[model samples]
Structures are given as C-alpha cells and as structure tokens.
Target: MSGFLPYGRQTIDASDVEAVVEALQSDYLTTGPTVARFEEAFAQFVGVRYAVAVANGTAALHTAYAALGIGPGDEVIVPAMTFAATANAACYLGAKPVFADVECDTLLLDHNVLDPLVTERTKAIVAVDYAGQPCAYPALRAFADRHGLALVADACHALGGSLNGRRVGSLADLSTFSLHPVKPMTTGEGGVITTDDPDLAERMRVFRNHGITTDHRQREQAGTWHYDMVGLGFNYRLSDLQCALGLSQLARLPVWVERRRELAARYIGLLAGLPDVRPLEVRPGVGHGWHLMVVRLIGACPPGFRDVVLAGLRARGIGANVHYKPVHLHAYYREHLGTHPGLVPVSEDAFARILTLPLFPAMGDDDVDRIVGALEEVLEDVR
Candidate 1:
C-alpha cells in the first residue's frame, strides 16, 4: 500500500544475482560460452533445434526477417495490434508490411483476413502472440503452406505460453522472444530467435554478430582468430552477463508462469460481475502467459474514463498502464502506408478501452486486493 505496485516487474532472486556475479568474475563477459549455453538451454526448453541470442526483440525480428530472405519488394502480413517490431522488421528489409485486423476477442491476427491480403509480393506472415497467448498456429501454418510463405511468431510476450501442448517457439518456422525486465523472464534487455531450420538459424547466428561466420568461442576452440564476414549484418549480439542472468531466470520460468495464471484467475473471479469492465478472452487450447492483465471498459463510460482510472490507480500507488496504440495509427505508418483509423477496427476499438493492470510474480493476495479495490473506487466515481 505504501510503495507503487508496478504493472509488471522482474522477480530476481539470489540465484539470478549469483549468475551475474559469476559471469562478472569469469574470463569472458561478452560473446562468450555463457551466451551459447543460454541459447542451447532456451532452444531445448522451447523444443526448437536452434536459438540465436541477440541484443533485443526488435533485433531478433530483423534478423529473422533477413534470414528468411524477406527483402526489397516483399510484403509481410502482420497484426495491426502488436508492437511495432512485428511490422518494422519488414521495413528493415526494405519490404512493405501489410496490416491485417485482429480477432475481436483474442486480439490476434485473423487468419481469415490473411489469405485475401496475400499477393504476388507476400513473403511471410508475422503472427504475434498478443498478451502472451499463442496465435492459432495450425490455421496460420496451413495458410503459410498454401502460399509457400514463411511463418514467424513474434512471441516476445509469450515465452512460457503454448497451444495444444505444443510450445510457441516450436509451432512456427521461426519464433522470437524478448527478455526485457517486465516480460515473463528477464535478461535485462536481451532476446533470442528460435527455429527448427538449421540454415535459417545459422543465418540469424551470423547476422546477430556483424555477419561473422564464426563467433569468438568457435575461433578459440579452433585455435585461430580468423573468421569470415559472410554478409552485411548488424552488431546485435547479447552479452554473456545478460545470458547468465537469463539462464538463472529460465530456471524459475515454470513457477512464474503458474503464479501469473493464478493471478489472472483471481482477477477473473474478482471482476466477474462487473458490468463495465471485461477481461480479454483467452481461446481454448492455449496457455496464456498473463504477461499483462488487460481489462476493457465497456459501454457508456466517459471519454476520459481510462485516463481517470489510470490516474486514480497512480494516486493509490498502483502502476497501471496501456499496452499500446494500434501500430498503424502511429505517425510513421500513417504517412508511409497511408493507414487510416478504420483500417483495423478491432485493434482501434481495443486500444480505446484497454488498460494493463499490475500483474507480476511478486504480487500476493494483498496486492491483488489493493488493485481491485482501487479499480472499483475509480469505476464508481467515473460512472
């Protein structure tokens, strides 16, 4: 009650600290064995054959786009509701991003809208797992296969999330994850690209580190410093120190996900009868990571109701916030793509009413109660 409860936060413990400390004390801090080890562990955990650690999620997306041969004149279909990186990756390749509206309830790309969008230039579909719930991969896969297009899952918010017992990363041709402090796990601003395709994985590996064919560790094992610059690439490698932290964090991922699920259930039960507020729908067969507990304000709410609720939560020492505005509504997209307000009605509608409340592993029943109490007060005052 005294301190500000954040919308999301990293739950670091002694093991995480020790991992960082050990890395700091070790010989290699940057581009070292730890990064590879972390990648291997992550790949195994996600049921993927390979994983490439990078500087951040945006870099992961860019690398994946480049690796899959998406470039000038190509088009990638992306959900309008996701983070900009899902579409910006295509821009990085000098390709255009074709925006598709999301499902009304799940806020994920509607596969029904996708096929019509695919043209002669369409190269891939970047399906985002919005709010930690996996997209309908089976349907997406079928569509991608019919068009001979790649399927990339921008799973930055869904590391521990899955569908029908199949992990998120393994479901797509390539999957990317973010390790920012507020995500399901943290590596203090790091990311990893997972894939079953060895060639694509190798491409991402080289691309993440200045297009170098062999990394420092590989050179050391071969007793030579010589390496080849395979192609044009960016300096997007994750440090060993970050990977060390990630490895420790990965060990706690299961419990963290479970706790998040519990918290989400508590919110559902608490707000069940509330008329003006509704939780986002989670489709059956998918395990939501609950990275953000988003609730939508319903009919007849004041125009400034969201802001009022946010201010009231802050006043009560809670850190509630909105996830995002529709990506196509941003200035750059409007100017470049000529995207307008009605382009993605579902995403635009969700943006107007959605609020992300505090939901982290560190929260307890008291925290949950505090948030609910504050929300109730704000709703009544605004109504």
Candidate 2:
C-alpha cells in the first residue's frame, strides 16, 4: 500500500488555525464582525458590490434562486455536465431546470444550444464553470439579455477563475461560490453569494438568516432585543469561526490559484504527446482556476474505460475520478424532468470519456510525474 493522493485536498496553514482559534476565543462565535469582514473582503476581491456568506454551496444556490424570484412555472436553464446542485437549486425553488448541452472542448454550457431551450417560462440560466474554467460569459450574457433571463454563474469550482480580465463572480447577474474543504480555498464548509444589485443582495441576506430583517450585530449595537421575520428563510448563516478561517484562506488564494495553474500547465506538457488522452481546450482570454484537471480518454475506449482507468490510478496511489454524469442522466432528473439518455449528446459523450486527475496547490513536480506515469501505464494496458 502507498500514500493515497486525493483528487482534491485543502491546504491549511498555521495562520488559518490561528485565525479560527482567535474566533473561538471571541464572545460572538456565530454572529459577529468576522462574518461581515469576510463578506466585505470577499466582495472586494471579486469586484462585486455585496456578498452574503451562507452555510454551504447548495444553500448559496438555493438563496440565489429564491432571491431572483424563480418559482413554480418558471424555467432555469442549466448545463447538464455539472454537479447536481446546479440543477437542484432550481428544483428547490419548484422551478423546472431545463437541461442544455455543453461545448465539446471546454465542457461548459454551449450557447448555441441555449436559444432553442428558451421559452416564455424561462426565468434564469445557471451557467456552471466546469472544471474551474469560466464559461463563455459574453455569449451567455447576450443570450440571457435577449431572452430577458437572469444569469447566475454557479462558480463553485471557479473561485479564482475569470473571463476577459473580469472575475467570475462579477461576470453574471448573481454568482455563487463554494468554500468546501477541497476547493481552492476552504472555510471547512461555507459558501457566498455575490451581486451588484442592492435589492438582490438584501434579499439574499434576509433569506440566509431565518428571514430576519435585522442581523444580530444590528440588534446588539442598537440594544434592541426584538426583531421581525420579513419572509420565509433558512438557517443558512455561516459562523464567525468559519468566516475567520475563510478570511485567512482567502488571503492566500492568489498564490494557491497560481500554483494550481502551474500544476495544470505541467500536466498539459507531460500529457501532450500521449495519444489516448486529451486535455480540455482553454481559451486565451480566461483565467482558469484549474480546480480539477480533467482529461478525456479518446480513441476506441469503451464506456467502462474511464472506470478502469480510475481504478488503475487508485491502485497506484493516484486518486483519479470523474467530474460528473450529465445532470439529466441522474435518476431524479429523469423522473422529474422526463429526460432520456440521448437528450444532451455532447454532455453524455463527454461524461463517458472524462476523468478528473489529482490536482491541488500542494501537489509538487513528483506528484505530477507520478500521475502522468500512472496514466501512461493505464493507457498502455488498455490499448
């Protein structure tokens, strides 16, 4: 047996621990200035006017959907090749999630297929930044504007990713980020919603904290013990302790993202001549976060080839995995959306060939070499 290399892992330092420790020592652990500070800092980092911290990525998505007033009878277009949360958020709002095919190269939503999916019922588009590469935002934005749809960037895998020099969280009407432990940065488990719209920001803030009109800080500062419940909301608030960890992790995000990019470049160079595997095409204008370095196994590879390669990598201490099955292929979606196998051809085809190789900021040259070596060996065996 050898040391297991996970597909993704958190990189925490002494400073991160110290920040959490300081928060633990403070009187206000859950509701405090740390959360506010984190929100402000995150908003500034992403060039957004406001940010609302929430419990997790799903909560962030749900809150964003709710804030946008998406409900039953409305349709939200989502890429099929993303995590289920992207589509599930629409379901949470009792809104239908219209599945769209992805581009063959980047695996992000294909704007070409979007127009056909738009209807009078379409209220929004939840564009995912698959594998940390930002989607074609300008095209998507134009499409959304043409259809009068709200564009939400499900940027959970793309915190540090950007397009046309603008950051991912600032590119859409509203953007959501996940700070899960395995992400580029971590707050143990947390998320944030960013937007420039003041009313949307307020709606998100209200929805994240039990629908309360006033937060604890405001109540405490004003010495008012009573509060009003403005609307139906959830207990989706992120604690100050988590926010402390987030602030510290955020400070190191630029360095971490750069390292991930370097690792991705190395993977690209090492895998270039390998005939059986192809890296996803990254367009020039985007700054990819490289959260997961996914590759498509090409040629006469069978449908089970990805699983075989994944198993081989695991046996060699390299934790290779798949990014996702098309959301429409999921049982729940098939049952609810009445989606069948052949609905999104590109997304389904990509799903069978795609494999997520181990990638993280802490990975070194040797790690890359080991993964490359294992992949080469696996491909040779398959051939």
Candidate 3:
C-alpha cells in the first residue's frame, strides 16, 4: 500500500516459490518431464487436446505462424489495438501483416472493418482477445470457413475466458498464451500454444526446438543417437523451473480470474460517478478475463487530458498507463508496411482517450479505493 501500484503485476505466493525450488532441486531443469506435465495441465485447463510450451509469447506466435505455413506473400489480418507482437510474429514468418481497425467501444478487432482487408493472398486471421475479452469468434470462425484461412487467437490476455461455453484456447485453430510476470499468471517468461489437430501440434513442437524431429530425452531413452532436423525451427523451449511456476499459477487461475472480475466491477461502479469516464462495452455472452481495466474519457475532456491524469497518478504513487498506441501508427510499421494514421480511425481515436488502471488479484478494496481517490483528484484538476 505504501509503494507505487503498477497497472499490472504477478501475484506470487509461497506455493509458487516452493514449486520453483522443487524444480531447481530436480535432476532436470529444462526440456524434461515437468514441461510435459505443465503442458498437460494447461491443455486440460483450456479444454484442448495439445498444448506446446515455449520460451515466451512472441515465440509462441512465431511457432504458430510457422506451423500454419504462413509465409512470404501471405497476409494475416490483426487488430491495430493489440501489442505489436501479434503482427510482428507474422512479419517474422515472412508474411505480410494487414493491420485492421478495432471497434470504438471494445478496442477489439472489428470484422466489419477487417473483412475488406482480406484478399486472395490472405492466409489467416490472428484474432486477439484484447484486454482479456474474447473476440467475436463465432462470426470470425464462419468467415474463416468461407475463406479457407487459418484462425489463430493471440489469447495471452485471455487465458481463463470463454465465449458461449467454449474456452479461449479451443475457440481457434491455434491459440497462443503468454506467461509473462504481469499476465494473469507468471512463469518468469514462457508461452503456450493450443490446438486440437495433432499435425499442427507436432509442427509447433518441432518449431520450438530447432526443427529437431525428437527431443534429447527421446533419443537418450531409445539408446540410439539419431535425430533429424525436419523443418526450420528455433530454441524456444521453456525450462522445467518455469513450467513448475506455471503449473502452480494455473492451480490458482480460477480464483485469480474471479478476483479480477470483482475488481473490474468495483472500478466500473466507482468510475460511474465520474461522468466523463466510460468503461468499455462488454458484449453479451462474452466471458471477460479482465487482464486490464481500461476506461475512455468522454464529454469534451481536453486533448491531453489522459496524459495529465497519467502524470498526476504517477506523482501520487499510482502507476497508470495506456494499453497501446495503435500498432500501425508505430514508426517501424509506417516505414516498412506503408501504414498511415487514418488507416484505422476508431483505434487511433481510442488510443488518445484510453487509460489503463491497475487490476490484479493481489490488490484489495483499499487499493482500489486509493486508485479511485487519486484518479478523482487528477480528473478534478484536469477539469
């Protein structure tokens, strides 16, 4: 309570510490039984047949794109509101990323705006569950079916969410997750990809391990040291130590998600008093995981009002931040992909007003109250 409250952070417990210590004490630290154990647990949690763990989320994205055969000349439509990694992964696979606009209210990819960007060369749709809210998957799935394009989910922000009783990982052909410290859970640094197709699962597994057909443990057990590099790949393996942490964190995911939801509701209730603050519109039947608590400023708030609020909150030991600046507006994308400001109008406008407040399981009622009080004071000064 005395220190700065960050916008997002991992909540580690004694059990998490014990699990990591146990992994360190084990005979194997990396590419061992623990990795498979964590993957199995995660797959079950996500209601998927297979889950491949990797070094990090970006690696998971790259592996998913590579496994799906997305390469040069192929286009993958993604929302401009998401982290750059969602599109950068396509670029890594030599594919062209066609940036798409997000809906003004939800800050999620707008298929109405996205469908026009599709072309004969479009190979996939990388639907990101921005801010932990599941995308419009039912519609997106039908569109992918019509176009014969792969549907992948950048679901790092939505590990515990669902849409119409279907879990996030099972919603798409291939769904990717992150284990960064600030996410719903942490493994120090790791990621996982989920898919029901065995072929895609195998391809992603090989893609994470330098295209090697079999892991070292498999060769060692066979007593025959023969392995082949079947396809192009990289060393994206997550260590047993990290997997141990992930498994421990997974056990607490449900409670953590519920806590986030409660905190989000409280923020909504509190922000309602401030007429100019507006929470994102959550569509019906969508199970939001609440990775971030974002609110848009309304009612003729000054042009740089969000910036003033951020500076004011920072000065008061509250670490508020913006979820994103539209990906296409970034310098690299503008220079390399010929993207411009007006490419996605709604997202660009949202970026200017959006402000992310702290929301994590570790925070209690007092924390929320403090953040709200700080924000109210900042908003008053801005007004």
Model 1 ranges off by over 4 Å = none
Please give the ranking of all candidate structures by lDDT, highest first, separated by commas. 2, 3, 1
Pairing residues by index, what is the TM-score of model 2? 0.98
TM-score of 1: 0.97
What's the C-alpha lDDT at position 21 in model 2?
Answer: 97
Candidate 2 per-residue lDDT, tens place, 352-373, comes to: 8999998999889789988999
Q: Number of backbone collisions per candidate, in order? A: 0, 0, 0
Candidate 1 displacement at residue 116 in angstroms: 2.1
Instruction: Write down the lDDT that model 2 would get.
Output: 0.92
Error of 1 at 323 (Å): 1.5
Relative to the unseen true structure, what is the C-alpha lDDT of residue 129 in candidate 2, on a scale of 0 to 100? 92
Candidate 3 C-alpha RMSD relative to the actual structure: 1.0
Instruction: Report the lDDT tens digits of candidate 3 across residue range 1-383.
Output: 66999999998999999999999999889888999999999999999999999999999999999999999988999989999999999999888999888889898888787667889999999998988999999889898998899999999999999998888899999999999988989898999999999999999999999999898888888998999998889999999999999999999999999999999998888888888789999988988999999989887656787898889999999989998988999999999999998988998889889999999998998898899888889888878
C-alpha RMSD values across all candidates: 1.2, 1.1, 1.0
Point out the worst 10-residue segment of candidate 3 by lDDT: 297-306
lDDT of each: 0.90, 0.92, 0.91
lDDT (Cα, tens digit) per residue for candidate 1, span 197-295: 999988998898789898887899899989889899999999999999999999999999999999999998888867788998999999888888989
Q: Considering every candidate listed, which one attains the maximal lDDT? A: 2
